[model samples]
Target: MRNILLLICFALMSSFIQGQEILGDWYGSLQIQGTKLPLVFHIKKQDSSYSTTMDSPKQMAIGLPVAITTVENSQLLLEAPAMGIKYTGEYDHTQEIIAGTFQQGGLKLALNLSRDNFTTAINRPQEPKEPFPYHAEEVRFYNESDDISLAGTLTTPEGLEKFPVVILISGSGPQNRNEEIMGHKPFLLISDFLTRHGIAVLRYDDRGVGKSEGEYATATSKDLSRDTEAAITYLKSRKDLKISKLGLIGHSEGGIIAPMIASKSKDVDFIVLLAGAVLRGKDLLLLQKKLIEEKSGIHDSIVNRSQEVFHGAYELIASNTKTNDALKEDLAAYFKEETNNSINAAQTNSLIESMTSPWMQYFINYDPTTALKEVDIPILALFGKKDVQVPAIENALALEKLENKNIEIFQMENLNHLFQESETGMPNEYSEIEQTMSPKVLNLMLEWILERD
Candidate 1:
């Protein structure tokens, strides 16, 4: 899931370039699995050099820095070393377009830039309107462990002196407080609905994302768990809210982190898992890749071959016996041999770096069952039948094996990972769907939480 976001955001940034003729804003769209992600590049000339920034309108990311920009002989180049992405495009002056290829982690995609000033807006009907019926406050809390302040929103039902509260933990990626993706703010919608129903909700930005402070690139899931613990502690200190019924509601990666906290802390009263993974990270990712690709209509043979390659890679990483440099060299050789040298050295290095990051290393080997088995509090695990990312049957069955009488698992039919009633249940359809969250699922969650005390 993290890799998917990295690819999408990197491809969007690929359209950004600094060229003499490419000043102002250049727009482009990267087509991924039937979804068109609209990207905009703001380019300006600074003395003899060029400066550029990227905007992913669909993803609601703006002013993303392009670390290196150069134009020579009509060839435009943009590089963001921090993200391990590079783009090279040839400016066609006659057509007023830049023909380019975006490359990251040995994957390459065609991304042509145009000066057409294309603007896109997704109509999210379920997104709460202003003048909300709840009391919303912008709040900040410090993560004492990481020495960083996290920014978030706290929403409470109007006229409620004290109320049950749940902290919203987002899925993977560097999400803001709203958990905005493809122009849909899931956390905001969830918070609004819960607050309206007399439940207080707190949703914060992930470390180093949005208004929060910390280094997201280097932080592992354990570090994120500490951040969540900080939120719980911060809430306990609030006199305006009741902490007696405080709990956690996490989506995907956040779902896993909730258990990690609950297993160790007595502060967590309950937990709701939304499309959480019950399998080990490597197993979950392999299945996720296969299912998502198969749903995207990729040939079985291709999907099988890709899975085989990744399986081998994952196995090597799981061993955890190799040093960083040694593992990088081994993986590079493996990828080179598997791809028949079609991938270049730079691409291989990029892939190695991403696969071996602190977070990825931890996630690939971590098993959520270790924490889930220890959680004795009431648990509500929900899954969308169409969620290819964490297939309903495999994960739900795994959760059931825990045999904890306090846990209840439900598989919502016709819904996707994001809980929207979906057709194909692909991530691409999340933004296109009119609903932010299925009312049935939301109601079920509210009922479960309310029933818990």
Candidate 2:
């Protein structure tokens, strides 16, 4: 569920004497693991200096400022200090192109930019248009425990005195209120459908993302549970929503967080888990790697060896006695040996850093069964048969072990993690799929919620 927007670079190099050549938009794509992430650089001349901003169309990130922009001798240097990104490229005047290498986080990749703006359009027909029938309002709420203000959208049916409400907990990432990814706004569409059917919905941005005010990188699952609790508190104060009917609808990691909150908080009456992970984080990730690799036609022997290396690394991290430095050194040695020294130091260090993050550490060690087993409220857990991230069979089986009469599990035939009707169910295909969410899943969820009461 964590959507990492890989940074793409576009260098606009031109002679200062003839700045007009680089004054417009330059387009390029960064090829990362078979995915072409489209990037657009909008450059403008301001007196003697130039200013530029970048847009990542695939990730829906726009107007990201370039901290330093310089052009001299038909060469360009664009640096974004915040993202640790730097691009240096030479301009070919006759070809109207810039050939460069984009470097960030110890990885260097080639990127070529052209004057012609070639945009890739993704069609998402389910995204709701403006002038929605329901009442949509921008709202803010406080998480007193963390002392941060979170912002989001609350959609309610018009003319309804009181209605059942559900707070939408986004998956693992710094998502906006819409849970937007690959140009699809699933949360907005879900809110629209639910609100239109007489259900009030609340969906907020991850802390430190969008309008929220908290540091995302430093927060853990426990910290996120507090934020969800705060959302419950905010809704309880509202007079137009039925407090007794309040529930939670969580996707991916959010699915895990919902049970964490509901196990203790009496406010949550029901919960809906969409593509939730029931297995421990380490097991879930290993299965995910195997499934995705197999689907990509990788050999079983290679996949098994890869899993073995990852398992060793995860085991080292799970041990509380190992210090961060020791863990990194051990993991690096293991990776080097497993890859026969083919993996470079920089890439190895990058992988180690990501694996050692606070979030990843907490996630790998945290087991959702402890929380799910304690949740006495009615629960509906849905999984997609083709979902590679959290395989439907394994997760659904894990949930079934809870044996809680209040819990109902369903594995859909052809849906993906995002609940979209998918082909291979790979993350790359999420953008290409025209459907935002399966209408059948939406109807099923709505019916389950309506029947709960």
State in Å the error of residue 123, model 2: 1.7
Using all chains and alpha carbons, the TM-scores for the candidates as numbered come to 0.87, 0.86
Candidate 1 residue pairs that clash:
none
Best by TM-score: 1
Per-residue CA lDDT of candidate 2, range 47-112, in tens?
877677677755545555566766678888876543456788888878988899888767788889
lDDT of 2 at 53: 69
- What's the lDDT for residue 332 in model 1? 86
Segments of candidate 2 deviating more than 4 angstroms: 3-26, 30-72, 77-88, 91-97, 101-110, 114-120
Clashes of each: 0, 0
